[model samples]
Target: MLVALAIRDVVLIERLDLVFGPGLSVLTGETGAGKSILLDSLGLALGVRAESGLVRAGQSQASVTAAFQPPPAHPTYALLLEHGLEAEEEIVLRRVVQADGRSRAFVNDQPVGVSLLRRLGALLVEVQGQHDQVGLADPASHAGLLDAFGGFEADRAAVALAHRDWRAAERALEAARAAIAEAQRDEDWLRHAVGELGTLAPEEGEEEALAERRQGLQQGEKRAEAVAGALSELTPRDRRGGGNPAAALRNAARALERMPPPNDSIQPALILLGTAQDALAEAETLLARLVQEAAPDPRALESTEERLFALRAAARKHAVAVTSLPELLERLKERLSALDAGSGQVVALEAAARAGRAAYVAAAGRLTERRAAAGASLDAALSAELVPLKLDRARVTVALTPRPEAAWGPDGQDRVEFLVSTNPGQTPGPLARIASGGELSRLMLALKVVLARGSPVPTLVFDEVDSGIGGATAAAVGERLAAVAARVQVLVVTHSPQVAARGAQHYQVAKSVTGERAETSVTALLPAARREEIARMLAGERVTDAARAAADELLAALT
Candidate 1:
C-alpha cells in the first residue's frame, strides 16, 4: 500500500506530504481545491509522462516521491530483483521533472528507467478514474483475472505442461522427417559408395607399405638385369665369339696341346689358355647365381602397383586422404544403416506427437468447461453488485469465445472478456464501448468488489467514482469502496458527502493565496473537522445545522 506521497513545486502544490492507511480514505474540498493536483502529483511519481507546466512558477523543477510497503509475496519484489534493483520491505518511487521537460526516475534511490518505474508502479497501485481504469480495462488481463477468480491454477499448470510436451514432440517429428527426406535424396549414392568401398577393403597403412614394396622390387629387377647383361657379355651372343668365352678358351688350349708335344713355347701358351678357361667358367657361375638371387617376380610388382593405384583413385573420388579411407568407409556404412532403420523411428515419433497433442486437447477441454462454470458464477456475482449502485438496468455478461486450434495457448482455448449491456434490449458489447464514463466507473467498482479476492494490486485509487450520482447511489459506491478496502487500501477523490462520510481517514484539499502565489495544501481531518468537511460537501460554501446533523447521522450509521 502507498505509505506516503511527497510533492514539491508541482503546479499549485508547492510542498505537501500525505500519509495513507489501509482503508478507504477520502479527499474532499470545494471546487478548485486542487484535489486533482494531488492525483497529478501521484501520477508524476508513478512515471506518467512529465510536462514542464507542472513545475511551479519560478521553480526550476518539480519532484514527487511515492513510498509503498507491499506484502512480502507481492510480484513487485520479483520485478525489482529481475531489474537488479534492491528489494526491501519498503519501495520508494521518485520522479523529478526539470523545467526544460526532461525527467528522471528512481526506485529505492537507485536510478532506473521511467519504463521500469511505470511497470513497478502498475504492480503497486491501480488508478481507476472516470476516464481510465488500469488492469480492469485491459482485455489481455481479463483471461488471467477469470482464471484467478476460478481458482484454476492447477488446471492451468497441467494444460501448460501438456502444451509444452506437444510442441516438443512436434518439433522432434519435424526434425526426423527432415533427416529422412535428406537421406532419401542421397540414398542411391550412399548404397553405391558403400558397395565400392567394401569391395576395395583398404587397410589403414596399406598405401605406404605397397609403395615401399614396389620400390624394392624395381631395384632388384634393375640389379638382375645388370647381372644378366654381364653374363651375356662373357658368353658372346654372335658366333664370332665362339658361342662362349669358356668354349673359345678350351678350344685354344687343345690346339696348343697338339702343336706343343715337343715345343716348350707352345706348352707354356696351352697352360696359360687352360688357366683363362677355368677363370671364365668360374665368372659365369658367379654371375648366374647373382642373377637368380636378384630377380623379382613380374606378377608381384604388377600387383603392388595395381593395389596402390586403386586405393589412391578411391581417395580422390571420395575427396579423402588414402589413410582416411577406412574411417570414411565405416561412416558411409552407418549412414546406410540409419537410412534402412529411419522409417520405424519416424513412425514411433509420429505416434508420440499424436499422443502429446491428444493429452493437451483433453486438458484444455476440461479447463474450458470449468471456465464456463466460473464465468456464469462471475456473471451472477457482478450482476448482484451493479444493481445496488444505481445500475439495476445494466447487465454484465462473461463472454467466452472459442479460439482456433492454431491459436490455443496455455490458458486454454477461450478468449474471456467482460461484456456489458446498459439497457434491457441493448446487445451486450465490450465494457469500455458500451458504458458511459460514470457508468464505467461504477461498473469497475462492482468488478473490483467481485475480484477483490484475486486482485494483486495492494492499493486502488478511484477518482470521482461518484461523479454523476448522489444520495443512496453515492452511499452504495462508498459501501463497495469500504468493502474493497477491507482486503486492500483504497483512496478516492470525491465531492459526494456520502462517499466522504464512509472514509476511515479524511483529508481536505484546499488552496491558499500567499502574496502573489497560489499553493495547494492537504490537511488530515479529525472527527470534528471530518463532520464539518462532509457537511460542507452537503451544503456547499455553507455551514448549516441540518447539514451537520445529517452528516453526524451518516457517520453514525456507518460506524
Candidate 2:
C-alpha cells in the first residue's frame, strides 16, 4: 500500500507531504481547492509525462515522491530484482521535472528509466477514472484479469510449457527435413566422391614425409656419381699399375733405403715415402665405403614422387589442405550414414511433434473450459452488484470467443472481453463504448468489487467517480469502495459527504494565498474536523444543524 506522498513546487502545491495508511481514505474540499492537484502530483511520481506548466510560478523544477510498502510477493519486488535494483521494505519512487520539460526518475534512490518506473508504478497502484487509459481500460489486460479471477495460473503454465515443447519439436523436424532434402539432391555426386576418397585413403602428414624422402633420393643420386668416380680413381682394377699410388710409394721407400746406408737425409726420405703409402691404402678403403653408402634406389624414389603428387592433386580437387583430407573423409562418411537413416529419423521426429501438438491442444482445451465456467460466475457476481449501484436494468457479460490458430498463444485460445448493456433491448458492446462517464465508473467499481481478491495492485485511486450521482446511489458507491478497501488500500476524491463519511481517514485539500503566491495544503482531519467537512459537503458553503446531525448519523452507522 502507498505509505506516503511528497510534492514540491508542483503547480499550486508549493510543498506538501501527506502520509497514507491502508483502508479507505477520502480527499475532500470545496471545488477548485486543488484536490485534483494531489492526484496529478501522485501521477507525476508514478512516471506520467511531465509538463513545464506543472512547475510552480518562478520555480525552475518540481518533484514528487511516492513511498509504498507492498507485500514481498508483489510484482514490483520481482521487477526490481530483475533490474538488479534494491527492493527494501519500503519502495520510494521519485520524479523530478524541470521547467524546460526535462524529467528524471528514480526507484529506491537508484536512477532509472521512466519506462521501468512506469512499469513498477502500474504494479504498485492503479488509478481508475472515467478517462483512465491504464489498467482495465485496456482490453489486453482482460484475459490476464480473468485468469487471475479464475485461479488458472497452473493451467496457463501447463499450456505455456506444452506450447514450448511443440515449437521445439517442430523446429527439430524442420531441420531434419531440410538436411535430408539437401542430401538427396547431391546423392549421386556424394557417393562418387566418397568412393574416390575411400580408394585414395589419404593419411595425415604423408605428403610432407614423402616429399622429404624424394628430396633425399634426388640428392643421393647426384652425390653417388661423384663418389663412384672417386672410388674408381682411388682403387684401380690393377692396383700394381695405373693409379697404383701405394705400389709407387713403397718402391721409392725401398730405393731410398738401399742407396743411403747411414745418411740422415736418405733415412728421413724413406720414412716419408712409407707414410704416403699407408695413407693411400686408407683412402681406397674409405672411398669404397662412400660409394656403397651414397647409392640411391630408383624404384623407391619413383614411388615417393608418385604418392606426393597424388596427395597434392587430391587436396586441390577437394579445396582443402592434404592434412584436412582425413577429417573431410570422416564427415562425408557420417553424412552418408545419416542419409541412409534419414527416413526412419524423420518418421520418429514427426511422431514426436504430433505428440507435442496433442499435449498443447489438450491443455488449452481444459483451460478454455475452466475459463468458460469462471466467466459465467464472474458475470453473475457483477450482475448482482449492478442493482445496488442503481443500474437495475443493466447487465454485464464476460465474452469468451475462440481465437484463430494464428492468434493462439501460451495463455490459451480464448479471447476474453467484458461487455455491458445499460438498458433493455440494447445490444451489449464493450464496456468503454456502452457506458458514459458515470456509468463506466459504476461498472468499473462493480467489476473491481468482484475482482478485488484477485487484483495484485495494493492501492486503487478513484478520481471523482461519483461525478453525477448522489443520495442512495452515492452511499452505494461508498459501500462498494469500502468493500474494495477491505481488501486493498483505496483513495477517492469526492464531493459526496456520504462517500467522505465512509473514509477510515479523511484529508481536506484547501488552497491558501501567501504574499503574492497561491499554494495548496492538505490537512488530515480528526473526527470533529471530519464531521465539519462532511457537513460542509452536505450543506454546500453552510454547515447547517441538520447537516451536522446527518454527518454524525452517517459516521455512527459506519461504526
Give the best candidate by lDDT: 1
In candidate 2, residue 327 scores what lDDT? 87
Candidate 2 ranges with C-alpha deviation above 4 Å: 84-90, 185-338, 544-546
- Tens-place lDDT per residue, model 2, 1-559, is 9999999999999888999999999999888999888888899988888899999989999999999999878888889999999779999999999999999999989999999989988998888876763566667778888888999999989999998899899999999999888888988878998898899899988888888889899988989998888777665567357666666777777777677445676777777777878888888888888888778887888988888888889889989999998888898887788799999999999999999999999999999999999999998898899988888889988888999987888888888888899999999898878888778888888889988876788999998878888999999999999999999999999989889988999999999888988878999999999989988998888789999998899889988
- What's the CA error at residue 421 for candidate 2, in Å? 1.6
Model 2 TM: 0.79
Clash tally for model 2:
0
Write down the worst ten-residue block by lDDT for model 1.
254-263
lDDT, residue 467, candidate 2: 81
Summarize candidate 1's per-residue lDDT along 419-489 as a digit string, tens digits.
99999999999888898888988898999999887778999999999998998899899999999999999
